[model samples]
Target: MISHVLIAIISVLLVAAYLAAVLAGNPVYSALSMGIAFFLTALLFVLLGAPFLAAVQVIIYVGAMLVLFLFIVMMFDLNKSSLTPVRFKPSTILSYFLIMLVLLTGFFVARSVVRMPSGFAITGFGSARNIGFNLMHYYLLPFELASFVLLVGVFGAIAFIKNRRGT
Candidate 1:
């Protein structure tokens, strides 16, 4: 009862935060909204009995990643004089349409997970030990691939900054 209500509230908050992150015109506000979304996602993980995931989410993403993003945003020189008010552009409309499409697709995909089988047990499912075991054993390749992708992204960002500076 109360747990369900709390979940609903948190879910709403998470969606609102993400929406704000996407829609905000100011980069700093967008980053802050993303941080709020990440924190709420961590809270949701905790409520779902995945404390390890929640901790990782907060420590790695909300703490480290958001700070890095904020630092990068601050490092760039944004010209206030060149800034213009947001208008109803075709790309913006398309992006909103795509967002709705993805949301609906996700809802449909996850609708089946609302009911669990009677024989299924969820004990220690999201534990650090289980996660580590799975990461090291079964999902090692994908994990390494993701890390490589992130590395590429960091280099790409650095290159972009260098190009912008004409250095």
Candidate 2:
């Protein structure tokens, strides 16, 4: 009962933050709100009995990605006064409507798929060491790719800031 209530409250708060982030004019606020949503999601993972997933969510989403976004936003230091205000065109409206229609259609189609209930609580499959071994052994390529992406992002940020300084 308490768990459900807590989940509901946190979920609502996270959704509200996400919506505010999406609708806000300021990009910094959007990034901050996204960070909040990511942290809340980690909590949600904990509530769902996935401690490993929760830790990964925190480390990857909140720790790494949000930090990168914050740094990028800070480094860019965009001035709203200098930027032109973007206006929506009829084509943009039409595209958004079509996307929404497609999403709705997909959701309805997927609603007919079989649902499985989680069985009684069971201990996790492997210890953290075991999971690390599997990830390093089996999923090494994907892990390396992810690391490469992070490296690229860091270099890209540095390059952007350097170019700005040179200009």
Candidate 3:
């Protein structure tokens, strides 16, 4: 009973923080609010019996990705004057609305399937041990490829920055 109440509270807070992040004026403030949102998401994952996912959410998204976003925002030398309110074009708003509608439709269509999965998971299905084994055995190639791509992207960003500075 208490856990359900806590989950509901956390979920509401998470949505509010996410909205704050999206509607923030400053990029830095947006990034910070997004970090808080990610932390709340991880907390929710922990409450939902997915501790490993929660740890990954905190470590990869909150710790690493948010720091990267902060660095990028800082690197651009953005200031208060540059962060003033901007108006979106009608086309852009319409596109966003259509995309959201499509996503919601798809979600509802999939929700029924999710509620009645064909196969049940084995014991400790979502545990760290199971994840590690599956990652190592089945997903090793794809995982390594993703890491390689990220490494290349980092190198490209460094090169771009260096070129901009003529260094």
Q: What tens digits encode model 1's per-residue C-alpha lDDT throughout 21-49?
A: 99998898899999999988986786686
Give me the overall lDDT of model 3. 0.80
Worst 10 residues of 1 by lDDT: 113-122
| Decreasing TM-score order of the candidates | 3, 1, 2
Q: Write the per-residue lDDT of candidate 2 for residues 51-104, one digit (tens) a residue.
A: 677788899988988888888888886986856777799998999999999868
Q: Model 3, residue 120: what's the lDDT?
A: 22
**Candidate 3 Cα misplacement greater than 4 A, ranges:** 81-125, 164-166
Backbone steric clashes in candidate 1, count? 0
Order candidates by lDDT, high to low.
1, 3, 2
- Local distance difference test values of all predictions, in order: 0.82, 0.76, 0.80
Query: Candidate 2: RMSD over Cα atoms?
Result: 12.5
Give per-model TM-scores. 0.62, 0.55, 0.65
User: Superposing all C-alpha atoms, what RMSD in Å does each candidate have to the true structure?
Assistant: 11.4, 12.5, 12.3
Backbone atom clashes (below 3 Å) for every candidate: 0, 0, 0
Predict model 1's lDDT versus the native: 0.82
Top candidate when judged by lDDT against the true structure:
1
N/CA/C clash count, model 2? 0
State the weakest 10-residue window (summed lDDT) of model 3. 114-123
